[model samples]
Target: MLMTLLMIIFAVMVTALALTLVLLISGVHTFSTSFSPLSVSLASTLFGLGVGLLMFGGALLLFLISFEICKLIVKLITPSIR
Candidate 1:
């Protein structure tokens, strides 16, 4: 269940990032731009989404790295438990 939930969250994060990046690359400005209100709004939304997903990506990396470390530790200890 936890893994499923994580997978769903990961999928959503990746989707949002991809969408925002596409818009940005296509020159649709986001909110933070020093330009017209409409373009700034679009750019801002895309930029915000991009930043948020990047932070979330960091969290995902941390989780995966920790999981690997824990698995390694468990394997190291399991031999003596026999």
Candidate 2:
């Protein structure tokens, strides 16, 4: 049950990462086209958001990995009474 929940969360994070990547690409394209104040601001905002999401995804992935490792260790150490 916990694994299933983690998988769902991972899926959502992947989707969000993809979306943020798209936004980052679009922002770069927009910046390349012109140098207006609004365009620059929008591009920067998109860049920041994309970077933030990427960082968050990395952290979540680490957390999931550690959780799984801990579960594995506990399983190995615990006696099989049943």
Candidate 3:
């Protein structure tokens, strides 16, 4: 059935998902490696970029808050109704 096919597809892409996880978890950014694109860096950088912009205009700086940034990024990327 359709559900089984979707599951198979998901299983096939597990390695890719794993690679993404490795990059996210270890913060291993190889700018000189196979991928040297801004988009790729953006995904990782956004997570690494702490300090959120408030509802009002102001800026705050954070020094090394990778986990927070990562969670913020997931919120940004998760789909919403369009």
Candidate 4:
């Protein structure tokens, strides 16, 4: 039950993050075509932030994968308590 709940929560978080990334990319694209200096700066900042978020998400996924792998290894090495 706990694992199922955790999975559902993670799914929601990933979906939200994906949506935010899509929005940020679209915003950057839309702002990049404008002639105003402010728009240009806004676009650049958005691009930077989008890139940072991508990196962070990738790292988080990697960490989670590694953690799960470690857990599996430990489970295999140790006998079940119950």
Cα RMSD for candidates in order: 9.3, 7.8, 15.5, 7.2
Please report, in order, the local distance difference test score of every candidate based on alpha carbons: 0.55, 0.58, 0.40, 0.58
Candidate 4 lDDT tens digits, 22-43: 6556555554434346655866
User: lDDT per residue, candidate 1, 31-56, as tens digits?
Assistant: 23435455457666667667655655
TM-score of each: 0.46, 0.45, 0.24, 0.45
lDDT of 2: 0.58
- In terms of lDDT, the poorest run of 10 residues in model 2 is 73-82
Which candidate comes out best when scored by TM-score? 1
How well is each residue in 33-81 modelled by candidate 3, as lDDT tens digits? 2244554666664543421212011211121233355455446545532
Each candidate structure's count of clashing pairs: 8, 0, 0, 0
User: Candidate 1 — which residues are off by over 4 angstroms?
Assistant: 1-39
Residues 1-82 of candidate 2 have per-residue lDDT tens digits of 5566557656755665576566556555554544445555866766655665565565556556655665665575455423
